[model samples]
Target: MESKDLKFEEVNEGFNIKEAIDEAKRCLNCKNPLCVQGCPIEHNIPAWIHQLSMGNIGDAMSIINEKSNLPAVCGRVCPHEKQCEGHCILNKKDKRIRVGKLERFIADFDSNMGLIREKLTPKTRGKVAIIGSGPAGLTVAGDLARDGFNVVIYESEPEPGGVLMYGIPEYRLPKEVVRREIHKIEGLGVTYVTNCIVGQNITVDEMFDQQNFDAIFIGSGTAKPKTMNLPGNTPRGVIQSSYFFRMVTLNNNGSVGRNEVPVKVGDIVGVVGCGNVAMDAARTAIRMGAKEVYIIYHKTIEHMSALQTEYNEAVDEGVQFLWETNTKEFVGERGRLKAIKAITNEGEKVIPMDKILLAIGSQPANRIVSTTSGINVDERGYVITKERPYGMTSRKGVFAGGDVVNTPQTVVLAMRDAKKVAAGIAQFVDAKKLLEE
Candidate 1:
C-alpha cells in the first residue's frame, strides 16, 4: 500500500507539549550520557531532556541553542538512528527515548511562541566572508557571529538556505522552518548576499583586498551532478535528481504547476542509483503523479547506500526497485526517452520509461578554486586543508570545509566540520590582529 500523500506541510508533525514531556520522561538521565557523544555536534541531549521533563520549555531551548543553530532543521533530517538514538542505553531494551522528536518539539515550540535569542554584542573580533549558505556555511556564520565577528554569506541561489532551501525536499523539511532559522542568524548581525555567486559575481582576491575580509570560509558544497557516459544520453526527458527536485518542489508558490513542469502525469519514471538522492527522486516522482517509479541500481539491496528508514519508507510508498542491474544505453525516439537497455543479474532486459532521473553522485564545482590561487585541492579536486589551524587551506587567511574539503556526507556532519572551521577562523583572526598590534 502507498503511504499517505505527502503534502507541502511537512510529513512528520513534531511532538506537542504533552507528548514531548511524556516522551522526555522516558530518559533515565544516564550519568555518562552516550547520546551526547554520539551526536555529531555534541548537543547536550540529557540536559535538554531534563529541562523538558520539568516543564521548562524555554530552558530546554536555551540548552539546545548553545550548540545548534539549526536545531529544527537538524532534528528533522539528522540520522538519529545511527547517531544519538542509536547510542541510548535504553535501546538495549528496545525502548530508547525519542531524542530527535523531543528536540524538534523544543525548537518548534520556541519558534511558534516567538521566542528569539537576544541580539549579540557589536562585531569587534574580525570580518569573515563565508561562501555558500548551506548548513556548513550557516554553521560557521552563526558560530563566528556569536563570538562577535562581522560575518557575511554569499549565496549563488536566490534563496539563502543552500541545500536546506533547494537540495532538500519540502516533505522532509519545510522551507518556512529553514527561513526561521536563517532569520535567527540574521538577527545575530550576520548578513546574506543572495543571488551572488562568489567566483562568478566576485573573486576571492576582491573579498580580501576590496571587501577587507579578515578571513574566508569556502562552504560551497558539491553541486555538479555525476552522470554515466552511455549511448543516446541526449534526450529531452533525462534530468538530474537535483534539478528535477527543484523544478518539482520549488515552482509555483512551492507546488508543481503546468507552466513549466519537468515531469508529467502518468509518466513511467526510472531513477538511476540507490542512495538517498535516488530514493528521494523516486518518491518525489510518485508524488508528482507518475504512473510507475522504479529505482534502478547496479548494486544489490544490501550494498545500497541509502538509509534503511528512507528505503523502507520509499517501499511503503510504492517505489519499486531493480537490484543488480546495469543500464547499457538509453534509447529514445525523436529526442525523447522511450526505453532503457539494461542487463540484470539474469540476462538482458528493456524497461520502457517516459522519464529518467540520474542520482548517481555529485562533485565539487571548480568555479571558486579555479579563479583563485594559493588554495590547493587534492587530485580528485577537493580542497586540501591543514591540521594545525584545523581547516585552513594553503592560503594564509582562507579556510575550507564541508563538501569542498571532503566527500558529501550528512548535513549534521557538515555542520560538525564547519564548527571546527569557525573555531579555527576565530583563532587565526585573533593571532593576526595581535601580530599587527
Candidate 2:
C-alpha cells in the first residue's frame, strides 16, 4: 500500500472490545502485582485489569489516568516485553497479560465515545514555563496542571509534540492519537505556545521576570542528528531518519512535500543502524514503493538495539539485513548517492543504492545551554541534574529531563524521568512561594 494511504491506518490493529476483555481475563490479579512494579510510573495494573474484566471500561480508564497521561500513546510505543509484560507472572508460561494492548483499548474507547476525563484541578499554583512539548514536557505539564499549577509549554516547532509528532512515523503512532492526548492535557488548563524557541524567541530570565513563571522545566529534547562521518561530500540522497520521517509524515505542511518524496518510487534504500528508527525507515521505504530496503548494521541480531517486534515486522515487510557489516563511505555522482562502500566479515563489499539513511543517534541541541547560564551540562552536552530533586539542574528552579538529561531509550522511559521532575517542580514551586510570602 502507498504510504499516503497507510498514514491513517495503524500498523497494529489494536484490541477490540471482546479481545480486550479476554486479555483482561488472563490477568491473575496477583497479590504482589509484579506488573505494577515493572511499570516506570507504577500504574496499578491489576486494578485496571480487574475493572476491564468486569466490563467497567470507564472505571478502568480512570484507574489508568490516575498515574498515566498518555495511555494510548504509551500502549502503542512502549517496549512492554522489557517492562510491564516481561514482568508478568504468566510470562513464565508464555501467556503474559496484554497490559499495553488493554491500555490502548480503554484509551481509544474513551476517545471514540468523546468521554474526556473531567478537569482535575483549579488553576491555583504559580505558573510554570516548560520548554519543548515532547513526552517529558507533556508529562510535567499534565501532572502539574492536574495539581492546579498554571502551565505554559513553549515548543520550538510549529507543532507541540516534538519527536512524537515528527520523529515517529504515522504507521507506528498516528498523529491524531497524539493530538487527542495533547487535547486531554489542554483540558487540564495546560496552555501550549508553539513556534516559540526559548533561546531565540525568549530567554529564561524573561520567563521569570516578564511571564512570572515561578519554575522552569527544560525538556527540550536532543534535536541534533548524529552522522557517521563518512568520506566524500554528503550526497543528496543521504539524510537523517528523523528528518526523513518529518518530511514524510508531517502531513505535507512540512519540509518534505508530497511532490518531493525523499526516496524515489523505485529507488534502492539503505538504512544504516538497527534501532527502531532504522526499522521505521526501512518499512516506510517499502510502503513508498522502494525496489529494495536494506538495514545494514555492524552487529548481530541479538546485539541490535531495535525492539524485537519491530525487527520482525521489518523482515515481514520484505526488509533485508546486512548483518556484521560496517559502512565506510558513500560513493555518489555529482552529489547524488549511488553506492555504499562497506566491510563485512569477509572483507570489502560495495552495496549500490539510490538513497542512504542514517539512524545512528542524536545529541541535545546547544541552544538552551549556550543561551542560558548556570545550567551544568556534561562533556557530551546533556544537562546535569541532581538526584535530590530528581531533575533539578544546577541552576535552581530550572530543571531538565528526558533526552536533554539522558537520551531516552523509549518514550515511556522519558515519561518516567519527567514524572519525577514534575513532583520536584511542585515541591520547588510550593517552597519558592512560601519564601516570597
Best by TM-score: 1
- For 297-326, candidate 2 gives per-residue lDDT tens digits of 999998999988999888877889999999
Alpha-carbon local distance difference test for all models:
0.89, 0.88
Q: TM-score per candidate, in order?
A: 0.97, 0.96
**lDDT string, candidate 1, 1-437, tens digits:** 23334445566778878999999998999999999989999999999999999999899988898899999999899999999999999988988888998998888889889775666878999999999999999999999999999999999987798888887888888888899999989988999999898788999999999999999999998888888899655678888988987776568344546545677878889999999989989888877778888999988999999999999988988899999889898988988889999999889998899999999988898999999998999877899999768899999999999987888898999999999999999999999999989
Q: Candidate 2, clashing residue pairs?
A: none
Pick out the ten consecutive residues of candidate 2 with the lowest summed lDDT: 1-10
lDDT of model number 2: 0.88
List clashing residue pairs in candidate 1: none
- TM-score (C-alpha, index-matched) for candidate 2: 0.96
Give the runs in model 2 whose Cα sits over 4 Å from its true position.
Answer: 1-8, 252-256
lDDT of 2 at 426: 93
- CA RMSD of each candidate after superposition: 1.6, 2.1
Clashes of each: 0, 0
